[model samples]
Target chain A: MIYELLEKHKADFFVMYASSKDPNFYYAVSMKLPDPAFYAIGEDGTEILVVHEMERRRAERESRVKEIVSLSDVGFYEKVKELGVEKALAETYAEILKEHRARKILVPKEFPSFLYKQLSEHFEIEIVSNPFSKLRSVKKSWEIKEIKKASEIALNALKFFLEIVKKERRVEELRRKVELFVYEKGALAEDTIITSGKRSADPHFVGEGIIEKHVIFDIFPKIRDSGYYSDFTRTVIIEKDEEIAEMLKACVEAKNEAIKIIKEGVEAKEIHDKVCDVLESYGYKTIRQKAKEGFIHSTGHGVGLEVHEEPKIFNSEEKLKSGMVFTVEPGLYYEKVGGVRVEDLILVKKNGCEVLTKFSDYVEVIP
Target chain B: MIYELLEKHKADFFVMYASSKDPNFYYAVSMKLPDPAFYAIGEDGTEILVVHEMERRRAERESRVKEIVSLSDVGFYEKVKELGVEKALAETYAEILKEHRARKILVPKEFPSFLYKQLSEHFEIEIVSNPFSKLRSVKKSWEIKEIKKASEIALNALKFFLEIVKKERRVEELRRKVELFVYEKGALAEDTIITSGKRSADPHFVGEGIIEKHVIFDIFPKIRDSGYYSDFTRTVIIEKDEEIAEMLKACVEAKNEAIKIIKEGVEAKEIHDKVCDVLESYGYKTIRQKAKEGFIHSTGHGVGLEVHEEPKIFNSEEKLKSGMVFTVEPGLYYEKVGGVRVEDLILVKKNGCEVLTKFSDYVEVIP
Candidate 1:
């Protein structure tokens, strides 16, 4: 698969180096904390791998690569130091590419600028933003199972949050309580969005103080064991406002319409615009200041190991794929009236998409 | 302070760039989103900054630097398209440097390699791996406060864990419940090492199962609000063994002795060896496979914001300093028999060190 990506981009090799702590490194290697390593894929299917000394024994035991060069045995840094930083990096990359005898290399946009420069010195190089991201946007069966497991846990916590809702409970306190329940289910509940009342206008509002009438709880937590991530959102109204109700109804319709149109072979942007149209028709101007006020951000984004991945459901020209997992979140935000958002996870199938999270809309709050 | 560090390194200018999502970027600039931004510090204390077009507004609003240029706004890619990638990048960097009147630049090791190459082409560039790591090693007043807050919450949770001890209650179940309680306190019960009996052979053995022997409960949680971290350990012997009790006493004494010698201007490695000497005097060797299996890893490590920081209290040549917070955990692990580790947080002061976490050393598990 990596060879095909390199060929598609007309590159001789793709070189990536990352520390054990980085999530990007985890994505490339598929095994967390395997080693401080570098991976390279040649256009003709030649793959070269290098790992740190302490990690070599374990890497040999568990890694997916066919060829492994242990840095401890090879004296990698000595070679680099002797060759000079640029020449050594370039030469090392070239040695990997030479197996296939290719002349060009492709790298992710976020690849270390100096390494890219070194490669460019010896071989033609191209910067491809998120070359691997598109591959990861879609989910496999096992991936969806893990995501569902995480979602089920999150929903249970959400239900728990609803049951324990109190007028005096602050947004911060509520978020902490919900996170505790979620993490106990064996997920790292990290990025939590608890926006209340007018604060919800920020969309990513990290709420504080006593929560008012409208509260938006957006949670995207990674399941620790599997490293699969799940995202969910639901807005509850404490003091009923007619405007809030009507706006929420529009967002629901928009989300439903987007889901209906989302499937393999569909354009991502079309679904995004369709949601926007639904909001606009409901008297919420979107797009620009002259447009609607309901939805400011995109309809949704692809979610997988990372909460937000590639094949963005935005103005992006990328096409949807069968294995892709994304969210259909439609929201309405008014400065004074507050915001209302409803989100659900979707896994694109051959014909359509499956909703992963099972939760009711219009969940009435007690008092 | 940053200017002084740059001057000390003889860097005419300093460039710090990290994606907004990176915590290191947050250390330099207080932005949370992904922004392709650069901060240039000049010899004359002048600053030149560049940011992504989309993030310009937010960067300007939040960052300490205000003189910002938009990477996309200046048509940077167009330059690469015209002048060729290397020359374009070098020329662009040169222009930025000239504007700041910089002939040499210091960059963090984590900066993208391509940027490093570009800067290197125009002027001398040094891989100054975030000088702030050292600055951050020493806890500031505010940072210490955060650590204290996190410690208090963790200690409280440890007390809860001790109170809930029942021989019948599964250790794993107790671990989960205690983590939930810790999170409810608005802190991350990130990891709790609950090891019992033979499992204690592994220094980091997180205990499992319902057993009628020694169980070690090590609580290390990060205070979310303050971003400060704390660590504490208490070993409970459900069924006491004379050997285990003796080893525990020696380990506790070693920890205390190490703490007493730990003050400003002392080498960390010296302290580590001193602790090793104390353990060896009791027939316990630092090597794991010896007759009396004892301390396998280093005595402890610097603990603050990230749990593990610089001036590692191991076989390190780094000197201890005032405001440096570290852990003094010494243990004697006996294979299949049991193990005892007493850990406490220590803050190096001018004369001696202050023991921060006030927890009982001897823990007895009542059946």
Candidate 2:
């Protein structure tokens, strides 16, 4: 599919290089770190993987590509010593393109210019739009399953926080206990947004102080082996107030309105506008002098290998896909009055979509 | 002080530029988003900060740089667009350097090459090896206070997990609770490493599963409004065993021994070797084969803006500094036996150093 996209995009052939710590490298080969693995994906549907000695074992273990060439076996580095590190990286990449006889190669915009410049020395390299992000924007069935598993782990941890510790634990202490619970459940919590009181007003407010009654527990976690994430947000009221309940209701309405409009082929930007409208209707103003103060950030974004992936679901013109998974989180904020946000992960299917998070909207625990 | 370094190095000027999302930009300008700021230190010891219009107010609120130039107020982006983003960036920077007109322009080596290429188009650009990491390596009195506050949050969170939460909460739940704790303490838990059992063997393991007996709880948090971070690691024995105890002992001993030799001007590699020797003496073999296996990864690294910063204290000839704050974390791993790591934030003082963490080492629940 990627090869077809490359061909359709008028790329004669593309050279894919993996560095020591690039996640894109991990995505292609499933090997975390490769000692300068190079792949040439030709328009003719031919794919070749060139790996340095250090990554051979893992490449052989998990690589989807069939053809594997070892650089050390061929002394690829020694051939480029005369060029130096900067030139060598470029020249080595060029060699792969020349070997494949690709005239015009499509490369990611974020490709390091030094290497890009070097590759252009041999091939007519164009900084092509990244198609990988779009491909990954949509989730697969297995991916959705993994997300569900991750969400289950997150929701369980929230349940534990409510049922177990009855007294007010230090904010940090609560975070640690929740993390341990989730970690034990075969997933690592991504950003555990446990903000409280005045701090909760900041959309990204990571709270401080002895976590008092009004606390917002927004947990997003990824399953280790699966590399799938689950996002959920629940406002736990240790101490209750009318404002808190109203804010919580506003948040839920905004989020639900957005979630309801999300489906295959739907405009992502329109969904964001709908959420904003819901918040504005509730007499809230956005922080950046916008309509809704609570919804300062985008409504939600696609979630996958990276918690925030591509095909932004916020104020973006990108259209939703059948397999795309995103969050429908809406928040309401008032500085001294505290804040409330309710979020759930959703997967766009053939028809409407499936909400992966099964937890209740309000899990009230009176501490 | 930074300007003095540029003068000493015979560079006419030095500038630090970062985009909106780049954290280093935040470090230099001390202002958050909307502030496209740059800290330009001239040979004459004149420090100038250029920020965008939207960020003018925040820049004044946060930064210490003497001159704050709001680009938008002076038609900076329009001028930049006219000058070309590259040429504009270069010419704007060159104008600052020309004020001194001494000789050379210095930039941090890690500065994006696009920026470098742009600046180099108009100025004699030289890669200025930044000592920011080293400068920030050692914690100051106030910095230590922040880290200690962060550590307290982490330790309290861990203790709460051990004492109150009996059943396995989902990993995400525990992480959220810990995060909330840190926020309440006026800080953000940068990343809390919560991995369990077999997952624990992988040092960077995160996410998924029921609460297992052997869980690795690594928490690093940054104090509110301050970028400084504190890191701590504690392995829990929900089900205790002699092997686990033995592993913990070896790891603690290795970490302590590594800290013993830590002084100003000591080789980073030597410290790593000493720790490795201690672990080996305890019948644990370092996995030299795979970088991810056994006692792989560096012994310690400088910590500040980012969790893992610079001046890696492993196989590095980089000399230590008095104010450098780094981690002296050592771990022992076995394929089936899981892993044990004891980490503490250390302030490299002039004489020896001070351990920032005051958490108990023993794996016992806090009553």
Candidate 3:
């Protein structure tokens, strides 16, 4: 990736550009790029890629790269007839990095601080911290097989939203039919939350229009041509009263006791202090007593190519390694039994983690 | 719009923030905030908003902010137990702009330059150029009724991709059934292009798989609860020989002679030089002679809540202002009948434009 940050910083190139505001330029040019093209890599590994001759034949059939040049292959319209399409796109990106003779570059920390203020006036930059979001927070083996095919299409769009929530009752048409059943199983939903009651205690409510009595689906998607992401959350409880059935059995036993203390080296704040010590030994109140109600947020995160990334189980100390991939999700809000999450998607391993949202944890909806 | 940039930069609080990399923070607190909350406006206009105590009960029911507050109202867990969670979120966003006593804060140019280098160590920031995307480049009458309800659902998903391209010849299953018919007609599609032949001369090709004899269909989207946006390109020429039927009648008379001189004050480079004077009086070659291919890109832009924004009908001098709204598409590429754009969606009026993508341009379907 960016030739291992241009041969680990003895930089002679690495560049990259907005690829629609850096998803580390599509994890370094896998390309679905919507303009602002550039790219680079070099330090002997050479890759190149530029763009904008009306996106040179779609970045030579969607990038693989080893020189895919353009800006009318240098002299971009003779520097846009003397420096104008905004200094002829930074002098044709400095004539395509002085035809690969580029010297000292690198970049990443979400580059484009206005094209790093116009190529830091011609060269020697640096930046860093976007090693494809710490190598997309671990996962490999085909990025965990495209996040296990986006967690099996977000567990078949949350079991097709419990069979269209007993013939649907709104919440934005059951989150547009679980985002068209995760775009007919090929993946690409976004903010797909069904949210209900007290707007499912607002964990970023995406709800609207009816469908109450405790809902919260939170599907999360991505796979469309391997952008790889997946997060799943459950909570349906249509008739489990006993105070949201013991707040969804303490959110499925605080997400199976913080996924039985994760794996490889643990301590993502000890699985968010073991889901805040089993939702504070079932008496609730969390954020370790900063308490904004009950078990307020955090008990999960780190999913691939950004469905929220990096270790973050919360109050982190980092550690947990072995091919990461996250989401433990032990929730339990309550403007009186509203949000009772349970999420899954695991993996970690080298001694413990795997789940990948096999589903079913607090869905009681048989009405 | 940030209270008219806090009474035209008299600035004393114009704030705003990341709401998913600022769509002008959902045009300033109309809210769908996916973190990086804070918002402001004041200088007597007072709006506030804040966030992150697990998003203060979903920004108090999706913001119309008079004040929503919450990094635990103020102390933020005693500044995250004394400046820890990344300097306790910049000391609880400086105690939520020192409870609105801010001092010259403005912002915008997509703010988050690492939270303006840590809120520029306390206020007096200023940035500008994002007055809700230049007041979302003019379209407001409920943002032109949510871009005419996303231009009547991208002209019924480009006439349902000409009846599913007479039996879906793949190209990702006709862009997943035209993004599940623009999500069962309520809007929220993305990069929906069906591209065909010679990858439709690469106007950012989104093509792949079977479909041939030319196709483009670029139906853009948006509406889901008025996040506005709507663009619609049509290029289906399945069988229209005679030099691709005279390059689709010179890209439909260069988008009808650039919408017969759009109204208000004209000059968006005179509708991209009258669609390059009817595609160089039909001999094509554009980028106004920078060529590289016939009629390459831009004869349209500006579209509400970003489907590309700001009066950019190409070589810009910016005018055409009557509550703007744009896209007049006029393309004409060639690899022997490869790209023939003809989009619509106009608006501009004062004595002229309207056509919010009424359909039927160069579609020619009967193979």
Cα lDDT tens digits for candidate 3, A1-367: 5476677777887676666445667777777776567777777777777777887776777677857888776767677656656567766787677767886786664453445556768888776666667777887788898899889888888787788888878887678767877876777887787788875876767777888676878888998776778888888877556777788898788888788778999788888888888878878889777888887777888888778778778886878888898898877777765777778989899899889888778576767
Alpha-carbon runs more than 4 Å astray in model 2? A1-5, A12-21, A34-40, A46-52, A65-84, A117-124, A287-292, B1-367
**Residue-by-residue lDDT tens digits, candidate 1, A1-367:** 5677777887778777765455556666655442236787766666666764434434555556667775434444466547754456556655666656768877765676556655666678776654567667766788888999988887887788888776446777787777777877798786587777775765655577787777788888788767788888888777787888898899888988888988789998898889988888877877433232457667788787777776568765678889898988988776677778999998888899888877887766758
List the global CA lDDT of all models.
0.73, 0.68, 0.76
State in Å the error of residue B196, model 2: 20
lDDT of 1 by residue, B233-253 (tens): 877878778878898888888
Winner on lDDT between 1 and 3 is: 3
Give the distance in Å from residue B291's predicted Cα in candidate 3 to where it truly belongs: 30
DockQ by candidate, in order: 0.22, 0.09, 0.17
Q: A1-367, model 2: which lDDT tens digit per residue?
A: 6677676777777666655344565566655442345766788877777764434544565578777765545545566457655566566556656667777888764455456655666776665545667777777778777888888888788888786547646777677678767765667663477888776765554455677667888888778656677778888887778888887888888878887877888888888888888878877764223432455666787788767676666655677889888888878766567678888888887668888886777767774
Docking class of 3: incorrect
Candidate 1: Cα lDDT at B41? 68
**Backbone steric clashes in candidate 3, count:** 2
